[model samples]
Target chain A: METLERLLLGHPFFTDLDPAIGRILVGCARNLRFAPGEFLFRENEPANEFFLVREGNVALELHVPGRPPLVIGTLGAGEIVGASWLVPPYRWNFDARAVAATRAFGIDAACLRDKCEADHHLGYEMMKRLLPVMVGRMQAARQQLLDVYGHPGT
Target chain B: MNASVAPDPMLPQPWRVQAVRRETADVVSLDLVPLAGAPMPFKPGQFNMLYAFGIGEVPVSLSGDPADASRFVHTVRAVGAVSGAIAAATPGTVLGLRGPFGSAWPVAAAAGHDILIIAGGLGLAPLRPAIYHVLANSERFGRIAVLYGSRGPAELLFHDELARWRGRLDMEVEITVDHADPSWHGRVGVVPGLIDKVAFDPKNTVALVCGPEVMIRFTVAGLRAAGVADDHVHVSMERNMKCAVGLCGHCQFGPDFVCKDGAVLAYDRIAARLAAREI
Candidate 1:
């Protein structure tokens, strides 16, 4: 299978998507590569794309002045990298840098938004798929914030 | 044959640490054998009150294989003074062992049904015995899967065993970490996230979860969402324990005693209490 077809067809987020919709997605997707320590995006930068991680890790980092930067999360294979593109002000909220050399399918967000507007079926399908990933990641972040690792000190 | 081989439940029996292996920065697994006394029997999910000769005692779960009668095993995370003492003890260190009291995981009842095991951090220690039991009798179960998560990729316990278990075709093993370094290429999320990644027949499945109270509550909710019945889900709960017996009341959860009625409880039995902010 072609890389485009495989990525669009195999992503859990796109499983069972209408082939037309998949085709529309493939039309806007482009392959990407990043070397270690390369910045995919910086804090407050334009969030024009979201990556379907194909290989390697991307560190979502929080930089605190006068202190070492902290990695909030790591995005890896079979995971979706950016959700900020789906929301406005259409700006990145954190620094995403390649922790290792990475390969991904970068989907054009503005293009996807335009496509969604032109086709309600595609828009609804995209919403149903990506919203779950957003919700799931938020829940995981909340659980991590709680550090529910056993009764502390027990 | 009795509840425990200890002549008296209040008095502690002496056990010598045969070996201690550091599992992580703060956690250590101790291999213990009775010095001169008879070996005490324990069931999966049961806990022993281990006293650091001079510091104090705390209830730690039995993490060893249930069928291995020659020694007892416990993985301790050094959180408090007593636990720190126990974790730092040498091979010849002598510690006090009380009753292995508590209700057990439904390993027997879960036979012939698919087994879904979910654990977080040290939660894996308590459920390790049940995993061993299920794998040893794999023919009796329809399917078995283990999902584990931790604070970070570095905090994961039993890394080697997880790899070995994943090598088997019969048992499905998945792991995730809340925070991970760049080197980690596996799932980066909570344990519950991996639940949907594995396959199990909810109609004929038994779910066992062991983690913090918050994690257990979320895990049970996830299992329910995945078509598992409330009655079919079980969780190992934690509370401060002063006495292994129910008398001290430190391990009380509403009317149920965590030390006596459970550390392992059916989801239906405690769902309401678990839902309330204060219990």
Candidate 2:
């Protein structure tokens, strides 16, 4: 529907996208809702889908032997989840669980990939938009790794 | 400086520890009452030099409500010998106290503007008094938000108080941790990461930041990126403090002694000092 297309275009990932490219992306996107505690995708599973969160929160987690899953990061409204879909071997690296009743637009990765392959401009645009998100997360993760809070000396 | 403080600032007055509450495995909050004279009234960002008998003295920020005249509350982490002795003291233990030192948070100047309080790790301990004052006088400010980040859930200070603040409708409180176990349903990320989640008019907002030096650097950068001017951002700096009075150069930060010029200072005043490697 045109309403869904417009809503999808408003997402940061799709914002400023050419109308033709947006329409192509909307074709592969569908509305999704998850109950609290529902797992959107599991680690080691095929990363066939990615999402643009419209409302609510999602936690990306990792499970360890004999331990509860550790939350790596949380994504909220207006943020994108699941960049693994863009890389080769197409598999999830962590489990994403809806921390609250959530609504999102799930985009089929294979469908978008085929479109990108057919049109280099669309592929270039997608890379241009997603790279920043990846770099931001990487930098934040690095800061966390520094354990800035627990340094022994003042 | 408080008017009631002893005229001889160098002399330590005896104060009795009224009670001790364990904040974490390594941190404790000591409620102290002056045994001789009136309790020294401290502004939100000021600190006290607490002497643990034969061991030594350490400068601790005032964490209690400013309105509470009966006792002074200090939350101390057992980082070294003197702090460990203070943290291990039981109720009724007598400790020597001096001060109510350093510049206070610019709560008056911050009126009519939004307030953003960013605290990381034990930095939350020093900022708690300022938060108490702001909440007690909430009508003077615009939107208010508190963003706190710790190493994890168990390391969080003031569990019940943080929950109460979160429940209030007037202000926003977002908490995050650098890491967490599987049971944590909250956010897991660096403190600066939460800045994007909250709403504030950056140009008209005043930011108060405290934490490790490295964390403060990153947080100030985040605020700058978010459009806040350097002058509007205030930071609490920690340094080696020996004499609570400005006479001892132990607390020197850049050209100013943190004991007198700050513990709380406008970020613009020290932006060059902070950026310099030699400082």
Candidate 3:
């Protein structure tokens, strides 16, 4: 459907793809829903799935001992989550929890990876689209750490 | 659907600076009159570029009321060359002006909602016009709160106005300093830390923020944690600008031009790009 194509093309992780590749991406994606407070994934878990939120809120939480679980950031509709699957150390770095009842489109990373290997054009399109999202998230994490309260002595 | 309609050229009529006021040690407020004798219609949060004589121009927010469009007003900090010149310029100086630019604070949309304004350092300049708009149309909104943080008392802009704002019965104003002097008898810490001390219903409130890049990032996070929605958090972004008309790539932030698309954007619209460095 055109709506699915529009949704895929609107996402930052897939927005810049070649139309053919975007159509291929839409074919591989499956919509999934999570209840509020549901864990989409846990830290150090196998990051085999990447998601693009279609609706509702999700929180990216990082836990440190003595310090409470800090909500470093929140992702909503039109945002990508679990991007670690694209790069090495294919493991989630933080826990993603559904802040509200959320509906997201889950793309099997291995499926996409397999498709990429089969079609280098799709691979290049996906990579080009994903690079900016990865860089942007890392910058946001760094900014969060700077804001979090910590010991001045440390 | 005709989604890409041409912009209404009549809305953002341009103006030129007729005079400049040195508001404080480092801040200057300009009084602008339209070059074409047309009224310059700008929403409160919009900004414009002021081109100096020899030096280039920079984007400065319209600190004046949007309802009164016969003249435009801008308060600028002397951060660099162009701003320093504008701050020192005498009255009757003219500068090239090209807006009432960018997405505006959703004042009409924010009606019936409490308004929270957080400004750090010179960030107050952009948010000032919004504060005036809200206060002037007080019945349209609920409680008003302002949280401001600066480098120190010496660097705080609008000290007298802030004092007056604090005294108003309809609004609550809190002032903080990143580093304070012995004489600075006010809150001391980052603006985010002050969020816990203030009281407002995030659901019924819309927040408008402008400040240093670092401060904005932190403030948005703080607001989110306090239960504000991304769409409801508006921010005014600052970047180096050569042309305020969006032709130059100097003010590009991801897919949007900070000049034309925004100096003010919904926090959600810019959150990802703002998080990225060198974008």
Candidate 4:
């Protein structure tokens, strides 16, 4: 749809100057929704999809061996959700659950990856943009490990 | 480094806990009033050594409005033995308070410039008084943008106050939690991630950061990359403290003592020192 192409190109992350490239990206973008408490992806699953949040929050959680799942971070509107797909061993590192009824522009990572390889320029641009997201997530994870909030008990 | 002008910075005065309000699951804000003599008032970004009856003492920054000298405030997280004891104490309980010490945030010097306040976890408490000063004198400062982040939605402090600040036309308040549950409808991510969403004149901005040292490091880097000068940025540093005065050298950060020289200092002053955690 023309509107879909417009929306995809309008995203801050996807300010494609080339119309042909925009069309190719729009081809992989699908409008997807997740119900409250529904998972978009589970940990260790194939990381074949990435999302541009358009409506609600998604909690990215990791399961502990003897404890309940620990949510490492959450993603909301105007933010990109999955970065594991960009790296090899393309597997979801954490379970992403819909915090509320959520709407997003989901891009099938497998299809996108194939296209990016076919066009190295686009691949480089895409990687350049996604690098910050990956680094931000890593830094956030490191901060959590520091337990900056301090423990509740003495 | 702004040294204390107190008559005797070492003496502990009895300060009564007038009220205590729970800010989060693990933190509480205590409103304290001196039992007898009125010591020197606290400046924004300054801290007091709060001594729980027989427990011990820990430096806590004043979290109240600096303009209201009647009762000072300190938000305490139950991080260790002494801090936990203070957080658990009753309203009528009396504690030993000493030295409203440390360098103040550049609230006075930052006039006519945009203020970008970035905080994380319990760091917001130290910056809260500085925020109040700006809000109280709205015309003196340009834009006031505050970005705060927590471990999770349940860990966020000052929910109601955050809403009120966000409601103000003069202040721009945005908060993010590292993680969230279904009930949370706000932004999610680290504190630094929210930097791109707000608008401020980078060249004319005076940034104040209070967070985990790593968060502060990253934030300072990001702000500098975005055009803020090293000297224009300030950070409230946290180090272990024994004596509220400079005599015990327990809270030394590189060349300076945190209690006397600064708990708050310009980023450029100790940028290299902060990079080395053990120093």
Candidate 5:
């Protein structure tokens, strides 16, 4: 628990936080593990939760008809997964699959949202911090799609 | 009433072209000597707008060492009339110079953090200074990694410098090309594709990216996908500018001015604008 607390504090999403707030964030998190080839979440699913990777790898898979599940990008330990929960629609844009056996700390989206609403500072910090991460991820996905693999007949 | 336009002290001091090195078929490096007594002072990642006699001016990054502020080095590719003229200038020719403008790469802040640089084509030119700054202050940083991509082997800039960077134990350099001929034996792919091959603790890493708008957009994504924070990712932008100052709206990216606000900005700072096709 102490080690997890340290890891949480170390993450950019929580780095600027006070230890008390960091502890509160850690307390709200639930640890989970997924084996390789397991589904963490599917595309278009209601995004009720977000995960911070602790170990192993996960691939953000985009499925197109008559095409393979293209690996748009991968995320590893210390990174946040499922950022769509921050904005409206609260639905995933891509499927997330475990590329290797993985461990992550899951935060209930509803609960976090409730806490954020109750404490605007927490809300401000989280959004202020996570917004860029979301944009960066979206831009990266777009880039991958525009890369050689994204181009037809490459 | 008209406000007087004061000469910007940050502008490059008048300099004479000392020599030119054909780094590759397309890229040429110019060594400039100050016309006066001393060389211009410029930080890494800042650029100088070079003016050819009758031609126009173009922003070119300073590729030389920041530690030695006297002699300035510029690496250029012939992409436009002004660029071609500047590249074609013979040794000892005089060229009008303005600016070592824009904020530099945050080498001081980057101290103790693992540094990752991703550059594409001419984008590598701006980032070359940051690479030199880090290498000169080698002990101040953790592992340093640079990933550069170009159209092909013939277009790769700083071949000798790339070789030297590859040889350093403290540094990691990766080169990729969009297309490769028979002579090309290295990795062949977009620069973003190479992000996964390097290992850096995103929690302790800061990434600097400069390249084409498309490449910069993708590289930021790659860094984030690799777990790097948006705030930790810094990017240098390329936009058309008639004036390097903010008064000219040509280089606008959203509410921010790429010329004054930044040619270099944190990924998070411009993330929203970057997501849009046009702004």
Candidate 6:
């Protein structure tokens, strides 16, 4: 069985994280798994945790009143899901469902937020890594809006 | 794939349409057989100037199997007047065609290395022939992966063929759409996002990319980030090709004529021109 410390240590997301910070993350992290088609989180729910996917895939979906949920994006093994935990209000913007049987590390958002509030060094380090992921997602969303494959001026 | 130039590059040979298969709402693939002499030999990335008799001529990529000598195939999206006429043609409709012009995908040069094919939207049409060649000679390459993306589920080209390729254990095929309804169980993201999802030795890999210019730009960046050299990356440039032989300057990008020097060229050769908006 992989211990929380070992798992957090091995993840790419913690590659350059300070040793103390890794230990702090391990304290807030716990193993999480979801069966195929199981919902990990829903839109408008309090974002209490974020996931570092260790295996399988997760689909981020948007629900419509009269239609089935539209899948906006997916996160696979080695990718992280849910940045909403970092912002104020901390509310999920989309529903995340496991596309396959998935294993991940769920890190408690409130626990980490409290620690960051106490330590500026940890907060800065986390911000450096988290900002890129948020920026990348934003850029991808912008590109999707361009509809490069569709007819021009659409 | 062979690349012998035609004797009269400007003269249009009549090719009778054997069948027309609609791939999408506005996209159609025309299967054509020669009305006179033997089928014109062409390479994977070469194109034909299809004339709609009374309409006009448009440069369309050859989208059929390079080994299939019975007929020529061109997948066209009804984007303009010339293409709309070409796409609307029925079986037995005879269309005029010029030489199999432009450079070809570097399948020969890429032997012994992993092959990465990235396509966006109808860009798959031009890369289809090269895909046929590579898969046919799979033993020559180390690993083969094809990453394709479209605006949505309905915009993807070569549906049946994509499934067939995905079934092969020797190759990897990953398809994504920019958007999808609930019915879609596959990926939903830009094509470049899939680059990191696949396995390839960047140092010993050759990448062939075809798509809208913006998509190509992003795909190139992803390849470079994965350690693939600029020279090892090739992109097909679509331009306003008036004279398929390069006499007209309509297809000129910087100093190279797309019809003559490319449709396919190494990324290093045109990195500056691709970044320039005026060019």
Which candidate leads in DockQ? Answer: 6
Per-candidate interface DockQ score: 0.42, 0.75, 0.02, 0.36, 0.03, 0.80
Native interface contact recovery, all models: 0.51, 0.83, 0.00, 0.40, 0.00, 0.87
Could you tell me the TM-score of chain B in model 1? 0.98
Better of 2 and 4 by TM-score: 2
Ordered list by DockQ, greatest first: 6, 2, 1, 4, 5, 3
Give lDDT per model, in order: 0.86, 0.90, 0.75, 0.84, 0.78, 0.91
Off by over 4 Å in 4: A1-3, A16-20, A30-48, A54-56, A61-70, A84-103, A152-154, B1-6, B53-55
Score residue A67 of candidate 4 by CA lDDT: 63
Model 2 stretches with alpha carbons more than 4 Å out: A15-18, A151-154, B1-5
The per-candidate count of clashes, in order, stands at 0, 1, 0, 0, 2, 0
Q: Would you estimate the TM-scores of all the predictions?
A: 0.86, 0.96, 0.60, 0.86, 0.64, 0.96
What pairs collide in candidate 1?
Answer: none
lDDT of 4 by residue, A1-154 (tens): 8999888877767865477888888888888989988999999999999899888878887877876676667777778888889889999988999888999998999889999999998788788889877776787677667665555332
What CAPRI-style quality would you assign to candidate 1?
Answer: acceptable
Give the C-alpha miss distance for residue B6 in model 5, angstroms. 9.5
TM-score of chain A of each: 0.90, 0.96, 0.81, 0.89, 0.84, 0.94
Ranking by lDDT: 6, 2, 1, 4, 5, 3
Q: State candidate 6's TM-score.
A: 0.96
Q: Write the per-residue lDDT of candidate 5 for residues A1-154, one digit (tens) a residue.
A: 8887887787656666878767767766777899988888999998989898888877777787885665555677677888888788999988888878899888889888888898887788788878877776565445544642221134
Q: What lDDT tens digits, residue by residue, belong to model 3 across residues B152-228?
A: 56778877889899999998898766543323445445677566556789888899988877888888888998999
Q: Residue by residue across B15-77, what tens digits does model 2's lDDT show?
A: 999999999889999999998766867788899999999999999999999889889999999
- Candidate 6, residues A64-132: lDDT per residue as tens digits? 988888889988888899988989899999999999899999999999999889988998898888887
Q: What fraction of native interface contacts is shared by candidate 6?
A: 0.87
